[model samples]
Target chain A: MNPPNIIFIVFDTLRRDICSIYGGDVKTPNIEEFLKDSNIFPRAVSSSPWTVPSHMSFFTGLYAREHGVHEDLEHGDGRVLDKIYEYNGDNIISYLKQKGYLTIGYSTNPWLSPGTGFDRNFSSFTFFSSEYMNLEEMNAVNEYKRYGKNRYEAAKNLILSGNFQEFLKYYRIHKRIIKRKREVGYPFIKGSDLIFDHIMNSSYEEPFFIFINLMESHEPSALWELDIDDRKIKYLDLSGREIISEKKMERTRNGYKRSLEILDFQFGRLIKYLKKMKLYDNTMIIVTSDHGQALKEKRKIPYYGHGNFLYDEIIEVPLIIKFNNNVKINIKNWNQSLVNIPEQIKNSIEGSMDDYMTSEYVFSESFGPVHDFETLIKEGILPSDINFSLMNEKMFYPKKAVYWKNYKLVLNGLTGELDEFTENGKSQDPNEKKEIVENLKEQIYIFKGQESFRV
Target chain B: MTQEIRIEGGLSLNAKVAIAKIVINDAIDRFKRPFVVWSAGKDSMVVLHLVRNVAEERHMDMLPALFIDHGQHYEETIEMLDKISKEWNFKVIYARNEDALSAVKGNKIYLKDLNKENQEEAKKIAQPGEILKDENGEYFEYSLETSVGNHILKTIAMNNAIKRYRIDALFTGIRWDENPARSWEVFISPRENPPHVRVHPILPFTERNIWEYTFKNNLPIHPLYYQGYRSIDGKYDSKKTSDKPAWEQDLEHTKERAGRSQDKEGMMEKLRRFGYM
Candidate 1:
């Protein structure tokens, strides 16, 4: 039997808090409009803080350690599987290909290009190649580590040697590099054009699986807007400002809201396209984010970018699925992991997706804190309002958080410290929480079989 | 002669018979002191037949059949009960109100053949049921309230008989599609106080399957069912409108308990919840 076409629209770094569907400040009409017919998972979490590892879960149905892609502890080491030498045909890409699906991919992030081993199974793949005008590419130019480890060593020596005049010159050159930055639209307009292009141009004679990774909601968003009143309400316009302050962080918070408006507009357009093509009913459209942004909301971690900590701000992402019918059902299975993305797709094809459950436990993990604890402390990250104890013992611990029933336990590998979040992410009930922590620890031990974890 | 009984758009005659056997062997017969509540209706007769057939095949003990005499059944039904009881050598128990027994004489209706002039005399001798009806009638109110009262009286008698026979589980032939309340009932229902259980073995069957199974097997049922009566309670609480038998009537418009006069008032569920099978 031919499988229904699968379209995975992953909004890179789009957090759960901003989507109005989950009761946030931003009004995402496209997402809300889709919610009328789709199933909304309010508390769906991401596997990782960034695009690379998080998308790996969607493909392999495996966590960080199991899939072997995690935070690059040794940065710029060729040991990283950024580019694949061969297609293994073991992951979701190959799995779907064997099922007779024509696989294609469109990415805006060069890091997600074939060089990063992210696009191996796509029969045809498209990347903008030159649009690195935002933060990631400009920063790559700043460190002089744009794409290679050779320049990284040279740039490290130049910055470490502390030649003030040469450093200023390099900063001037980096400013010039940023000035030439493209992708000024940030995420939405260009993306919608590509989606509509696919729909209008396709013969669509056979079932096809299209994977889209849009990077508009990621950090350093410029020119994003939505009119709330006579005056426009949006994230701060970070045009020429490089210096950081309380003013900048507040604007970044607003930036997330403005980014959501763009996401909603572009997403609505594609949905309209799907309907116009009359493929809305038979097609399976899944919209979710790879992970969320920190926005420095709680001051738990510093900076507006993610990949530093496992706060709800960083891991929680909105998930919505629309297929044929519009009957809304509450699927209360708390154990749905991001790693089961492939399984969800398979079940959708087989007509056996149980909206209520997938397993007893869903997981989220981090190789280490998004930033090394030492860097965070040295960066004056712990605000004066909070205590030192939170970052003291549990700081350096490489952790994995498992959600069970009504409790979430963060298993710290370094100190074996079990950090608990109770119902609605509270931590007050120690007596009841400890027992659950211990049982979940044991379940993990049984699952891994070879290692012992401190409860 | 198999009935293509469409239940929930799925159930067929083979499925109905298979479900009957499974419910009997798996749930009903699992309990000690199990007994069948036979109403001498098509449904109850099928339950009895399934049990007898299971016993013959598996060498299981034959359960005692109990009947609650509400003093309103026809003479032919009472006669068929005696005949079937003797033929199968099945132990039979009768539960009835002691005062009402005297009103019935030798397998005949109580005071039913009286002249219009003698009706007042009969009314004077009539006793009120546990539940009183506002409307006036001879011997009984003949209203839904009276039917509910009679149902309670019958249930009390059945409970007494259950205690006498030490019945732990009572097997019934109620189908889900039969009535509104039964649709929500399960195959095995629990009763707390007496620690008794109600096992409904024919829950998934439809009315057509009941009739077709009986017609094909030539199983004995109430004689009134064939005499233009689809269902039975008594002459006063019944609809004898059609000339054709129950199975012969169009199944769509033919309600299972439409003939039961009290059932028209929709009090059957109340009686059912009160332990009246």
Candidate 2:
């Protein structure tokens, strides 16, 4: 008997709410259709808020404490890789490869490319350059310069010019110049297209494990065919410019929405191709994200991003597992960690794994400081010098958490407060913070074997 | 008058800092030939980072670490081990119990494997002036080959490597708080045997302390912690429960019973019945 083939897909920085299946506003029909027959984990929490560590955890099944590649700092030396391997030990790819599986990985995130030890287990791994920007033929840099200053006007001008390619070029260039200036040096390549081609062409001789990471949802949103003017928007917030007009923000959001729609369409096509090729049935397909992207929400803090803090927007992601055989499981009101996916896959293949637990407790860590730190410093509960790194040295707490049964805990690092919420997303009484804090403190003190520290 | 108070139990901030600094310093001092008993968990990663930092501080010696791999581990454990080893130049030794067990099964009966006949014979021989001896009337001579089985037994086991290197001292990044077995462990201890000593430089450290240290020092750590894992032990528990036999669950049990946990004794007995001890 042959081992089962595995197809793992990670949409980079995709928020859970954006998926139609997760009760978001986006019209992700393809994703919704995929989820209908698949095992969807509605409450899958990411291992980390960033690409490097989160992806590492996905492969190794060990937390950052065990595998040791927690930060995105480029040590500029090869020693960092050595440390990662020492902690993670053997990777799943190598194990699968040893078991006669062909492993391949493709990613658009530069951080997860070959140099990062992510390539260690895969027989073949490829990272597409960010230069290609999008499927549109326009260069990202030029597009930004043309329309980024005044998005509405620029978009209007491109529309009037009646050149869709010019509009795409403007959008790509604006996106590239605005946020990812460092990547401008690299050439562009259409990663999604490359991946689609690979999937269609790869040999299925041995059981194959293919990992694909797409960065279409990453910030500085770019889209080629949004029904909006590119010239009327103002993109340069860096030049001491006035605040971006509401119209521009709206257009940006609209463009992002349109891009997501396009991605969904492409995904549908890929799925259709897989089914047509008769490879969709036996494959154990996993769809998830490294982490969710923050779309500028005020969670006591007025900004949106993942690396500097932990929040539901950043850590909570949609996890969908679909097998060739139709097996239906409705996992409601259950909080599952993404780390359990590998074990679940094994269980599915071998029929000898534990059932998903009910009273599961999830843990998370962040090395970088968040708004909670500022709050703590302001209240004199923590010293000003107690930054993210400093706090991480002294404590281990998730930035945001949802319990298996909906007893949620959100630790605001900046405020030094742990807020409790009901499973229905209702906030608990403020008085309950004290008890939660006390329990958390006790757990920390006991877990660390330190009896001297009192809360 | 000055209080002249002697601080007991709780460590001061300065003391904590000093201890942390010493950990870093000691790690740096042995940067050239640092080897960690990598268990693919959090404590071990802390140990790995200390060694990395030490090697970086020296700017001359390249520290290579090693992990004695037990065969039965989670998939993530192996992934992390391979990932970290590739990134940090750590040498991994994946030891297999099957081979070791096969090698020693033919010649000897480990205490756990003693059959009823052997038990009765040993009991009879111990009687006053009964002359305790093997069936051949000679002193019982047990060898590794005879006891463990020749097919599985190797001359030099993974445990023996530490002794063979004449290691100045072996460092383990074990924290007392996480496990009851380690809660009372001291920072450093002399091994009962020569040429090997056990050191827990991070014993006094907390999870937060390690994270803070790594963050402040801009040290690298595994990312899974950020996702929601408290520590790196791969065994996922449905709930935090104490399931071990009462006697085997605490230090007092080991002290009372010749260095064996009651759970271990039970396991040994089971293995003995199966002739695999």
Q: Per-residue CA lDDT of candidate 2, range A264-296, in tens?
A: 776787788878977777777888888886554
Lowest summed lDDT across 10 adjacent residues in model 1 chain A is found at: A227-236
| Best candidate, TM-score | 2
DockQ (model 2, Cα): 0.03
**Candidate 1 runs further than 4 Å off:** A72-78, A82-89, A129-183, A186-205, A222-244, A299-303, A324-330, A369-395, A447-453, B1-277
Q: TM-score each candidate.
A: 0.51, 0.52
Candidate 1 lDDT, A408-447, residue by residue in tens: 6666655666554556677655566667766767444333
Q: Write the per-residue lDDT of candidate 1 for residues B38-115, one digit (tens) a residue.
A: 878788999999888876776654566878776667788788889998898766667665444444434322334343
DockQ-based CAPRI category assigned to the predicted complex of candidate 2 = incorrect
Cα error of candidate 1 at position A309, Å:
1.8
- Worst 10-residue lDDT window for candidate 2 chain A reads A231-240
